[model samples]
Target chain A: MKTLLITLTIALASLSALAQGVKVGDKAPDFNLKNVDGKMVALSDYKDAKGAVVIFTCNHCPYAQAYEQRIIDLHKTYAAKGYPVIAINPNDPAVQPQDSYELMQQRAKDKGYSFAYLFDEGQLVYPKYGATKTPHVYLIQKRGADFMVEYIGTIDDNYKDAAAVKEKYLADAIDALIKGDKPTLVNTKAIGCSIKVKK
Target chain B: MKRFVIYMLLVAAVAASCTRGERPTGELAVPIVDYSGLEPYLNKSNDTTYIVNFWATWCTPCVEELPYLEKLSREYSNGPVKVLLVNLDFPKYYDSRLLPFLKEHDITAQVIMLDDSDTNTWINKISPEWQGSIPATVIYRGTKRQFFERAFTYEELVEIVEEF
Candidate 1:
């Protein structure tokens, strides 16, 4: 019984740690979520790809809205090259009505998004990735059967003006991965709206 | 009696001027300042605890938490705390959005515009734990500081300030 108690304690401790989600160099976790097109999509669906640009963004956030065109352009530029932009709206609709699945679908159609925009329903996927804010980017590259968290944080240095962006962090990371090399600048941060999770 | 009437009129005019100082009339000029003008406010060597809140006009949670910050500033008016609302609104939106929002809310805390876009380098300089999210706040007394990246209730905000 004493040994059982110790084993249980260790199990709970590890569970709490896993709850904090993935970090750099860690194996990226996979999820089967519904896309804006009413079809189910998963990271495995992009099995043929070299890497993935998993972006947590929402329709309501001004920061996310500002990057919409940039994100669309990223998908257009990289989808044919094996690294595609996988947009995810991690915000709970109950908390932010504008980020609801219906609105997400509308935004995807209206914006002419060429990539898979998934909805993290029941608020499951984001916390597993430890996503803190909208417009947060996690670049994952597949190695063997597992995808590794190569880079985490923002898309670029500037969110206000895409033309003014000096450092394209996401594009740079993807380019390096394509060349079988590590990114020169791995991680970055930018002022973004906090992910609207349900209370 | 004539001298007394003149003195009362002078006092009334001086009182009106003081109120004007708190809030300027006509088109209010929102000072657009860079990090140089802001460094002094953050690096004060005095005993006052500075509660610096980073916010933008478009950020929902930031706007939601603004009231709590405003309230805390008022409650701690005579105390050792000073609240500074650093507006991170885009320079283009300063006249169109930010200034109008400030005027509409009648925000009492000291507000200033931060125009720098090199956030990746400076975010860590502000706080290592900051994820560069709005509604983030830094409470500091001299060099000792604490940074919170999430929204805070009035009670939660006061709890932190009172602890310092």
Candidate 2:
């Protein structure tokens, strides 16, 4: 019985640790990383703005690639109002053959991204945001001086078929914030490639 | 001179052995079938509960939850419960990832790589709310199947396995 208790404890602890990933109501982690332009960017940099859209992304991962255009559209639509999409690459190029700095630049330049494409070298920022996959998005809204994640989830309900899109989770969340209302679906799931880290 | 030659040959032998690639393929990797394809593998009379975990090599939570799933499989082996892992590692993870990953860990449950094109057709086909999330699981007993997202604990797993 004692052994079983210990096993149970270990299992719970492990799950708890593994599940450190934040949910909808969790506070967004603060981070500062060098963007593609070699300029330092921080979550606080956007403090003066109404809110920010924090997204984990990379050069590889077909799933992430699939949302690239949609993400661009989101930034184009919302940056003027308040929320600016901050795309962060969480993969360590040292481990991921496809996520090298050079490839990232090529991808960004080719895609004509207007948002900040920061590199999370060593993945110091991803875990804090509780991000699990590429293209994972967290919407942070600035209430007073602090920021909290308002909506966390997929870009939209349609990655497979944009023509058949029925729901727009991120877009709706931003719209809710604009209307001074909290988003209804704050936490949603995204399917994408895993972020690779170097040992 | 004789001793030096012997040492060189021994070093050469060691290097050759070390470089000889992953273990000889043991059990053939099971293919992750679509919802329609899953019909053949499932026994209709099986009142025994079955947990089918959908995972991939690149997915952190999926990889992390493997051992716990293995334990669940072990527990079920003693009774009318079963666990099957559907690996979404895809074909890309085979050489650069899966084979090496399998060799590094001691895995006991059956592992399958689901190679399906056009995820759109299958996402809803598997379950309406899948949302393409990895580390999701589908638990079944007879005609009933309960789907769960997120990783599992041994106790939580046991509870689900024994529920039916």
Best by DockQ: 1
Q: Can you tell me which runs of candidate 2 are displaced by over 4 Å?
A: A1-12, A15-19, B1-164
The C-alpha lDDT values of all candidates are 0.87, 0.77
lDDT (Cα, 0-100) at A135 in candidate 1: 89
**A143-169, model 1: which lDDT tens digit per residue?**
998889999988888887898999999
What tens-digit string does per-residue lDDT give for candidate 2 at A16-99? 867776666666778899888778899888866899999998887767877888989999999998999999999888767678
Off by over 4 Å in 1: A1-19, B1-28
Which 10-residue span in candidate 2 chain A carries the lowest summed lDDT?
A190-199
Q: After superposition, how far is residue B45 of candidate 2 from its true place, in Å?
A: 5.0
DockQ of all candidate complexes: 0.61, 0.14
**DockQ-based CAPRI category assigned to the predicted complex of candidate 2:** incorrect
